[model samples]
Target: MSLQIYDTKIGKKIPFTPLRDNHVRIYACGITAYDFCHLGHARSALVFDMIVSYLRHSGYKVTFVRNFTDIDDKIINRAQKQNTTCAELSQRFIDEFYIDMKALKITPPDYEPRATEHIPEIIDIIEKLMTKGIAYQADGDVYFEVEKFPQYGSLSGRNLDDLKAGARISINKIKKNPMDFALWKASKPGEPKWDSPWGEGRPGWHIECSAMSRKYLGDSFDIHGGGEDLVFPHHENELAQSEGASGKPFANHWIHHAFVTIRDEKMSKSLHNFLTIREVLKRHQPEALRMMVFATHYRHPLDFSESGLRDAQTSVNRLYNCMAACAALTDGTESSKAVATRAEIDKLRSLPDRFQEAMDNDFNTAQGLGCLFDAVKSINRISQALPAPPAQADINLLRRGGADVTKLAQIMGLLSQEPQAYLAGYQEKHLTAVGMDKAELNKLLEERIAARQNKEWGRADEIRDLLLAKNIELKDSQDGTAWYVAGDRGQ
Candidate 1:
């Protein structure tokens, strides 16, 4: 089946056809690099990451570009406050952004261009717009004449008269139109600037993406995407600047992911409720955060909550637990990996097709996760149904089952860790959140082991109940007592 995605420009779900056969080029708007990265940033990064992952998994060669807004008004203001240069401040945060992304296990973009690095490209676009009469200079500042481009509001769905009525005051008094936005801003005292034909100034917000994308992905690319908040002024203005300069389509399709909200309100640092990736990682594994994102469809708003995040941690625990079980069931021997029977592993064999069906529909990770958990359930059932000294054929089937489930999960950037290692990390984080340490857990387990050895059943049960109250679960087998914080375990 062909891939389908919702195009924000056309405002409909359409069959995705790349401009080049078997190749896809995409550019996603990246961070402003003026502050620490938050969940809002995480959501956008993961959304695009999943899209790229699925595209490559489907055998398409993908070139992904996510840019950095290294030169901006925000960067200038923040630099003056911190007593640093715009270049230093912006690059500092750019490094911090990469740290956060690495902790989140985000795939590094193929090309990470910065506005400051592409000054020449920015100037070239502005010169083209100026020569074509699409943009004009007024008192050292250059503004795009919205009235000059007939398709100015096509992407944003705004009209001239309504927009004029909505804005009673023009941001720049000398501009020809109220809705006209800046292409180049004249330099201010102590602000970073590059010498240009328009005088000493920097590129405007919208113009940066146009120049960076054109330089990296050409005048027209297969896809352009970002957070929904950029649609109105940022993307709309970018669309105008690129097409107005090149006289061609800016992007073949546009993909916009919805906002991440907290308590039904949008997540933002200004609202004072934003949680940074660093803060979240201090209490939860990175894979847990990735799962929390995949739990919701990209086009839908993800209502953030502490409880919801904990649930995602629990879900990760279950996935890794299932992996551990499958491995334990089958000894890693050549005979154990041989094909058992077609009927024995039929459900396991159906993963790729089942997963592709969900993802092919606008990258529906939530539905793809549903398929994932169903396979998890199937393997778990197989593990439970095995006899004490399992037959060779069943071992082979279990080995195949474990490998198949892992392959599918890895596509969505989950279950990439060794099962034991993942479970240890997941348990440690939960342990820290609950104000307990693994040292304490080990001590308690030691005491319980003594109680069980003495055959003091009541004392042993009391210790188990005490740990259970702390959300730590336990299992008993011939190997003795084994426990991890596997969540509430259905109470």
Candidate 2:
């Protein structure tokens, strides 16, 4: 099926046709850099990341731009609270954002512009708006004239009257209309400021995205994405400012990921329920969090909970175990069984098409992941049916299956680790959680191996029971007995 994306402006899924053939230009509104990223930020980042990945995988030359709001009221306030300058505070959090995105395996955008760095572009847009009579200066402050733009609320579907009634307008009493938003804010004492036609001031929040996106992705781009919360005021204002200034559509497609919630409550710092990406990574494997995010449709709200994360961890464990089993069957030796398993391997080749079909439908990662799990199940079943030390043909089949699974998972930024390494790391994490010392566990394992070698079955059984009591179980393979946390053998 052809790619279809849900455009928030039109409120329906439409075919994704790029303005330029064979190329897709996308701009996603990035973080404010005032604090560490949270689950909500992860969802938006991963959603757009997956979208860009799929677009490129489908043979489109995608230039993705995501901007940082490094100079904002929040950053200023946070800087003061932390006893630092705005630039210093914003830089620290921007660094932290990169770390979080790296941990999540999110692909970096082609252009990551910072609002502070695009001051010239911002000033240029503001100047254009002033010349076009779409913006006016009020006591050194510049405000977008909402009434001047006939379609100001078309993207958000809110008329000017309704917006004026609902908007929390600035109490400065300088704007001509209640709904007029600031394009440039006159600098206050002790605040970061830049020289502009409207005097020394900084660009407003909405204006920053418009200026940065235009600078990198052009005045009109293919897709503009962010969280659903940005649909109004943020994105809506962006449309007015950009279109009002350039007299062209700001973006052809509008995509927004739903919020990440905790127990039905929005996860926010104000709510005291915000879980930073770093904290979540420390508690669970990063892949597990990625899995949890992809489990739900991108446009749907995701409920964050410890149980959900644990379930996702279990799912990732299963995939890795399947990979490990497939790896074990593919030792370099040749066997006759390879020919017999060829059909199963051939079946695995069709997975990419299935995965793509799910992703093409508005970047439905949940369905795409479903396809991945289905392949995992097929590989596991094939492994069980294959004989130990099977024909070279069977080994090839298992190898093919493993390679195909890894390739598909990599597109979603999962299964990047070696199967053995992932399994071992997961085992170690569980061991630590259960307070099992690795050194002590290793000593017991060695003693048990010696007992089994000497035919002291009772003593070996005793050691097994002792380890099991601590939630560690021993799996005996041809090489040796390996210990893992009990109840987590990827069963």
Candidate 3:
């Protein structure tokens, strides 16, 4: 079946036909890098991550681009508050962004361009808009004239009159209408500045994505995604500027993930309700966070609550427990693996169909997760009946199941760590004390084989306990036992 995705512009599910065959290009509006990453940012990251993961798993070459708005009001103000340059401050947050994404297991985008890094691209786009008469210079600032673009509100479904009414116009004497947004902002003293036809200034938030998307992807791309809050003014203006400048459809599909609310209220740093990934990881496993985020559909609002997380934790634990039991089971007959293999294959084959179905319908993550949970159950059941170390056939099935889980989880930025590591409170010291490091743990585990083969159950159990005490957990397979360190398992 064709991969179907909901097109935000048309508000319907449509087959994804890439501009180029066997290839997909995606653009996700990345964070502004002004503050610590928040749940809202996580949602956007995960949303597109899933899209890319599924596309690749489905055998398409995916070029994913997620940009950083390294220059913005918040970034400038933050730098000033910290008594630093905008570039310095942005660099700090960029580092933090990577750390947070890594902790959440979010795959790095194929191209992670920064807005400040793409100044030339932004200038070229502004030049195009100027030549097309879609944008004009006003008081040394380039602004896209709202009225000049006939399809100005087509994406957001609001006309110029309604937009003018709803928009909050500051005391800007040069703007012809309140709805007119900036393509470029004139630089202020002490702020980051770039040389442009409009003087030393920076590109506006909307223009950066359009410019970066065009530079890295093309005049048109397959999907452009961001948070729902960006639907207006941000994403809306991106459409106006990109299509208006290029005179081509900017993107074939637009996907927006919903916001995250805390305690049934809007989450704001001012409200002190903003939940950072670091903060969340303090109390829950990364996989738990993944499950929590995916419990609801990407296009729907997700409420943040302690109770909700507890539920997710419970669910992930159940899956792990089932897998552990499967690993522990020992069936005498070799044919046991073959029987388990057939069952596992059936389950694996069914995964893509259901997962795709959910993703096709507006990126319905909730439904996709439902399908994933079903697959997890099937895997656990097959494991229960498999031979010890699982028949070579069963071992293959286990690997496939692991891949299925890992693939879906990668899209959600979850489960990148070894399962055992995730369950143990792994630390660097413990990793080193294991007489091995992450890179060497697999080989060192071979030494333990002799003890187990010698039927030194007492010695083998001691080694396992020692590893566990050091925040490393082991999973014994027919081949051998492997270990992982759990990063965030308890609060």
lDDT of each: 0.87, 0.87, 0.78
| lDDT (Cα, tens digit) per residue for candidate 2, span 436-463 | 7789888999999999999999999999
TM-scores vs. true structure, each candidate = 0.92, 0.93, 0.79
lDDT of 3 by residue, 1-491 (tens): 66777777887778878888988999999888888988878777776777788788678899999999999888888889989998888889999999989887778899999999899999999999999888889887988988888888777777888866766768678887777788899988888889998799988878989989999899998889888778787988999899998889988888887788987776767788898988888766677778888888777789988778878877776655544444444534455436554655787777867777777665667787777777777777666665444466665666566577667756665555555544454345456554656666555466567788998888778877766666677888986676555433453
Residue 201 in candidate 1 has what lDDT?
A: 90
lDDT, candidate 1, 131-184, per-residue tens: 999999998899999999999888878888878878866476798888888899
Deviating ranges (above 4 Å) for candidate 2: 167-172, 331-347, 388-394, 431-439, 450-458, 477-479, 488-491
As for lDDT, the candidate ahead, 1 or 3, is 1
Q: For model 1, which pairs clash?
A: none
Residue 6's lDDT in candidate 1: 91
lDDT at residue 269 of model 1 (Cα atoms): 81
lDDT of 1: 0.87
